[model samples]
Target: MYRLSGVVKRYRRGRATIDALAGVDLTIEDGDQLVIKGPTGGGKSTLLQMLGGLDRPTSGTVELDGTDLARLSEAKLTRVRAATVGFVFQNFNLIPTLNAQENVEAALVPLGTRAAERRRRAAEALESVGLAERRAHLPSELSGGQQQRVAIARALVKQPKVLLADEPTGNLDENMRDEIVGLLEKMWREHGLTYVVVTHDTAIARRASRVATIRKGHVKVAEN
Candidate 1:
């Protein structure tokens, strides 16, 4: 679960100060599914970064399970991210040289998982994502959808408590988009993950129990 209060993220752009998150107050419960929608420069992704402990806020607090991420040391934050959160991105962010299985195993490396256990877990993750047959394929060798599935496998291989996806289906066609979204939903249910996604697709928004619209560093949440 996440509880963000008075979260403010400010960046310096030349002489001007840009507030990516002016003051965000939000709560996400365990097993909750939330979709964040907003304009290009809005604070959606910034907020996601806060939740995932990928960035520190300029002011206020971002708490996950009662631990304030903003207060953690970099070493502790890295450990929390490695053990608690999973990320999927629009670009897939796979290493072109690494095969599907290797990319998934890479996630476990941060935890100092042994090679044999890493291989077994990565294979099971790829199988769960319907990519077992493509384990040996590199990112360049797979279709866009397949590549994204590999990304999903990599994210979930560690059995993270929360899944944060930013524009996960953005690069796919309509059919493929639907497939990926469906797969995400299935994984959320089966894994009991607290899912938060930033997306522009209205179809994906419609499926969420709650939708948040963020603009100009402000956020407004609505129930379905």
Candidate 2:
């Protein structure tokens, strides 16, 4: 579902040129659970951005479901991301004011789904994340793990083909981390969703079908 061929991403730091990704060649198949592990500043987040159509590569190609993201117009890439991809962050990027249900429904607003249908789907999504009863709670009222669950619900409410998670377990305790990983595994199986998770946790990496480590600016497969 994802293919990156000789992908290079370079940026300027003052006058110095820095390469975030240097010739990264990687592929993520449909329904794959791929874990990307690396030290800080190794370009794992940049790679996820490339996969999600959030950033364009400086060179080479990033193809998602046969569509080359680098070749798309910004408007077209936005549409692709809205229609095909979902993202979860380590920080649980939920709005403080919006309740859990509203947060999930917000994702459907861009797709022009009817209000009633959006509500229904949002309820179902919350249920999937085991947050059905807490749908009315605000982010401030929830624990860190609960807030993360709300974020996951919001991400999955779109029914995206692929989910890009950047250090989803970074802000949680070990037990909460295990819970989140198990929840992701359940969702992947139920939705047949493709997952590319960028994390430094070895336990999370072990849960994936494939593991790749990024160092400096290169990608190395730990094992398949």
Candidate 3:
């Protein structure tokens, strides 16, 4: 479902150039659950951004379902991203002004879904994350886990084929982390969604079918 061939991303820092990703080559099949483990600034997030069409590669090829991302215009890429990827972040980037259901409904804007259908799907997504009762609550009214669940609901509302999660369990306590991880795995199985999760937490890393360790802009599979 996703492929990256010799993908590279470089950034200028002061007078030096830093390579975030150095010729990354990866393929993720449909329904695969993959984890990327790395220290801070190891390019795991950069790779996720590339996969989600949030950032363009400096030079190299990134393809989603066979369409080359490097060749796409920004508008075209945005459309592709809307249809293909869902993102869950550690910060749970929900709009403070909007309640849970409205936050999830925002994801449907690009898809041209009707308001009624959007609300219905948002409700269902929240239910999947065990947040159905909290739908009308604002982000500040909820616990950390509940806010994160709402973020997950927003991501899932679109029913994206690929779920790109960045440090998904970072802010929660151990019990909350476990709860979120369980819900994520359940959603993956029930929805047949492909996932690439970036995390520093060992427990979260253990849940993935495959784990790749990244360091110094390079990645390798860690032997069990």
Candidate 4:
């Protein structure tokens, strides 16, 4: 569902030009659980951002479901991201002012779904993430794990074709990490949610059907 061909990204830092991704050629098929592992300063997060349509490549092409993301207009890309992609961040990016239910509903606004339908889908998504009872709670009112689950629910509410998770378990404890991974696995298998998880955790990488190690802006290894 994702294809990156000769992808290049560079940033100017003082007199030096840093390449975030240097000719990255990668493909991720539909319904695959792929884990990306790398050290700090590697291009894992950069690649994720490109795939999420949050950033454009300096050169080359990024295609999502046959649509070349690099060629899309800003407005069109925004719609594509809202309708086809979901993102989970290391720090749960939930709105502090909005309750869990409202946070999920925010994603549906772009779809122009009716208020009643939005609430219903939001509640169902929260329930899927095991946060049904906490729908009315604010971010501060919930524990760290619950907050992350809310973020997951917000992402999943779109029923996105692909889910991009960057350091998804970075802020959670071991038990909570395990719980979150378990939930992800369940979603991947049950709903066929395609996932590209950016993580440094070997255990998380091992859980994926395929694992790719990025180093110095290149893919060093891919193990199936």
Most lDDT-accurate candidate: 1
Give the runs in model 3 whose Cα sits over 4 Å from its true position: 222-224
Off by over 4 Å in 1: none
What is the Cα root-mean-square deviation between model 3 and the actual structure?
1.1
* Reference-based lDDT, each prediction: 0.96, 0.92, 0.90, 0.91
Candidate with the larger TM-score of 1 and 3? 1
Residue range 1-224, candidate 4, lDDT tens digits: 89899999999999999998999999999998889999999999999999999999999999998888999999999999999898899999989999999999999999788999999999999999988999999999999899989988888898998899999999999999999989877877877878999999988988887887888888854666
CA displacement after TM-score superposition, residue 166 of candidate 1 (Å): 0.4
Candidate 3, residue 170: Cα displacement in angstroms equals: 1.0
Model 3 C-alpha lDDT versus the unseen true structure = 0.90
> Which candidate achieves the best TM-score against the true structure?
1
Model 4 misplaced stretches (Cα beyond 4 Å): none
Residue 14 local lDDT, model 3: 100
Residue pairs in clash, model 1: none
Collision pairs in model 2: none
- Higher-TM-score candidate among 1 and 2? 1
lDDT of 2 by residue, 108-216 (tens): 8888889999999999999988899999999999999999998888889889999989999899999999999999888889999998899998888887779989988
Instruction: Return the TM-score for each candidate structure.
Output: 0.98, 0.98, 0.97, 0.98
Worst 10 residues of 3 by lDDT: 215-224
